[model samples]
Target: MIFRTPPRAAILAIAFLLGAGFFATGAAPPSASAGARLALGGVALAFSVVALRCARMRIVASDACLKLYGPLFNQAIRWADIRTNVAAESGVDARTFGVRTPVIVLTSDRKVKAQPVSSYSFSGGTDTPADRIAGQLEALRQSS
Candidate 1:
């Protein structure tokens, strides 16, 4: 089973636009130094790479293991390694974003196992998506 966050394409588009804005900044300023332009372009390129990598974040669960793929790192764990409810950090997230960010705290050895990564603002407020993901993961874990 694969669970993905909503607005996956929107996140990718925003990131791409932001990176383009950075590059455009270097073009507009009349006194932009070569060094400044180079620096901005470098940052823009790095953001683009990261955006491409992290935007389509998803959790893949197979019969043997669950894999989390994203920007920071990727991890795969056998379903047997999961020992608790696959759930969202709703309360903790609400403190910062006034919404339950769609981050499933897939736990294994007390570390994150998978999530469809997105900012709270973009991921939406309704806990439905997060809850749905958690429920699906729970189902997968039990079946495994």
Candidate 2:
């Protein structure tokens, strides 16, 4: 799974337009649907760009080792090197962890594997890619 965070410009534009849409939609006099559609389109475009540019994290298992590669970091772990498999949620990190937008934690040898990647703040909060990565890693662990 590739976890990607939208670029600043994209995020800003989306936030602005979406906020505008919400305000416009909720005003004393509702704005036209056309304006809302345009705002939504801009948000979609931002997502598309992030999806295209962000590197995906993947697990390729072999008899010798498990290889993980993605935007932030890469490593190959022989079966013996794996201490344990776990499932965990990304903690309350607001883009400071260098984790992809939506922070998910992956554990290895009593430590959490992390990567430094770009992220942006949304109207709700900052988006982190960790949850997606953690989910993929959990699936890989279960399959193995």
Candidate 3:
């Protein structure tokens, strides 16, 4: 299945940033307010771009290996390297995939190092989509 970024999130981020900029500068409450607005606006803009990019998620499972790529990161996992699929709760606001976080923890028979690839949360659909992707990965692993 294919997953793409949510346009509404990007639009909202831009709009909020612009509106905050205008209102914060217009008011003379304190310079801190302007700075704060600018900071928040910057974060919003950055996240918006991330959201746009991470919106795309691709999962391809073959007997040889499993391939997964979304906007934020990409990985190719061999059947022997990946462990069981784990379901997790995540959300766009929380910067996690859908309501549940979907992740595949890599493992090896010998001592080895592993790292978690953080998932992107850009919209309400993040968690659920991630779970779906995880499901795909598990299916692939089983088939292999």
Best by TM-score: 1
Q: lDDT of each prediction vs. the true structure?
A: 0.63, 0.45, 0.52
lDDT of 1: 0.63
TM-score, each model? 0.71, 0.34, 0.44
Task: Kindly give the stretch of ten consecutive residues in candidate 3 with the minimal lDDT sum.
Answer: 109-118
Q: lDDT tens string, model 2, 61-100?
A: 5656666544335676665555443333334345554323
Please give the RMSD of candidate 2 to the true structure. Answer: 11.7
Please report how far candidate 1 places residue 136 from its true position, in Å. 0.7
Candidate 1 lDDT over 1-144, as tens digits, reads 776775754566576768767775745477878888787787777777667766667777888987877765688877776775445555444355533333334344475634454334334455556666767777777877
Model 1 alpha-carbon drift over 4 Å, by segment: 24-28, 91-109, 117-126
Q: Candidate order by lDDT, highest to lowest?
A: 1, 3, 2
How far in Å is the alpha carbon of 66 misplaced in model 3? Answer: 2.2
Query: What digit string (tens of lDDT, one per residue) describes model 3 on residues 1-144?
Result: 333224433444466555555544543446466567777656655655555444444455666766665545666677798777765455344344333455666785332111122334455554544455566656766777
Residue 15 of model 2, lDDT score: 52
RMSD of each predicted structure: 3.9, 11.7, 7.8
Cα displacement (angstroms), candidate 3, residue 137, comes to 2.5
Clashes of each: 0, 11, 16
